[model samples]
Target: MSILFTRLRHTLLPRRNTVARPSDRIQVALLLLLLLLSLAAAAGAILLGAGIHVVESARSVEQTASRYATTAVLLADGPSPGTVGRSGTAGEPGPARATWVTRNGRRHTGDVDAPAGTVAGNEVPVWLDATGAPAERPLTPLAAAVDATAIAAGGWAAVGFLLWLAYRCAVFVLDRFRLARWK
Candidate 1:
């Protein structure tokens, strides 16, 4: 890494004896500027990803606190006819209507995605909020971490790509200028 840094430093600020043209100086400056901005962009992407993960984790915590789980009895077989076309992979669940009673002893009905192979009269676990309304399940800590990492990596990759493209264009222009000068 130190060797790489030394090389980069030399490229960006070559020895005075090696400097021959104004265009070389400009190219070095542009390269250094682009490298600095790319580093800033990568840092920004990490911060952005952390923010998203925190918000998502807080939401998940809140949902977990407010939601309760219970067994819901399916009302129809094969996840209802409407969901037949929307079925996911071989083992994924499809949408269905189910009924469940909350802690207060009041019965409620709602649409839920039941596991594949579940049939009418099968009891499936469901999540409900304090108001007896269906609620989204919370994400596990591992899942949140994975999601944040993936988002950060993708964002960083995009920034790197843009910086690389700009660097390429700058080098192309500089090469053309050098050729013209030689001519």
Candidate 2:
């Protein structure tokens, strides 16, 4: 089959006569495969990252639509200093009993984040979901883009490393085969 291919190739394009060994053919095939894998890895990483960014951006928009920011009046003193809250950080704000008025003029009382050792009647900023419950702020567009870019770069680097390892292994094996044949 290789002889036929060589004859066809020589006839199609005139070039200096040179025999292509089976090992050389195999090596050339592997090189082409490696190039294809590298390209695929790059494209896949970029596509996945773009998908993540789109999903995150849409989620941010949905959350922003149903969430709002408001101020709440503390009904009781916050946790004493040096006490960690849910976030496990003593310096971070702790949940405290607080009351706030909603846009519909309805009164609500719930737990809200306030600085440690906060006195009663102090006002603190908070975000409320559609149900008027304390909630987290929505993700911003800039944050989504940053997350996507980081994912894309990390994924590409990881795949590129693997591809490099494969290339190294292939070279080692092919070189050994060539050396053994020569010997």
Candidate 3:
């Protein structure tokens, strides 16, 4: 620990024997500024995570209030027809026709996604909105938190990488100037 501290101290406050070059001072200042910005980015990550959680929570609350789960019997096969999301890629779950009773005690039949290889007459649980329409499952709090964390981590990593690239470019320019002076 002491060895690490010594290295850090030296790196942050190197001993100077003579007047420092203007370029050297500028480089140091810019590095310090980048460090400060990195700290701010860390804080921003937390705020972003909190924002994600809040949005997901509100959506879950709305879904739970407006939707209810009901048991449904498969009319044909498992899985639904067409793509399930924006990507237009079908998941392992296939499309099938299922029948269930709504909250108002009305019988309804619709197409829903079911486990692969599911046959007709198989009973399955499905979510329905207040209007007796089929609805997707709501995101859970845990899932929201995980997604937020991943996104924040990716953001921080990107910032760090950009800073490193900028530092390398600065070093290259400073080296070129020093070489020109020597020549």
Which candidate should be chosen as best, given lDDT against the real structure?
A: 2
Q: How far is candidate 3 from the true structure (C-alpha RMSD, Å)?
A: 3.5
Clashing pairs in 3: 79-94, 79-95, 80-94, 80-95
Q: Rank order by lDDT, top first? A: 2, 1, 3
Residue 3 accuracy (lDDT) in model 3:
100
lDDT tens digits, residue span 1-183, model 1: 999999877777788888547788888888889889989988998998898899878876777788888889999764433343453445567767889899999999878778877898999988888999877776766777778888988998998899889989988999998998889
TM-score of each: 0.79, 0.72, 0.81
The clash number for model 3 is 4
Better of 1 and 3 by lDDT: 1
RMSD of 2: 7.7
- Model-by-model lDDT, in order? 0.82, 0.85, 0.79
Worst 10 residues of 3 by lDDT: 79-88
Model 3 quality (TM-score): 0.81
Clashes of 2: 0
Worst 10 residues of 2 by lDDT: 9-18
Worst 10 residues of 1 by lDDT: 80-89
Model 2: lDDT to the true structure: 0.85
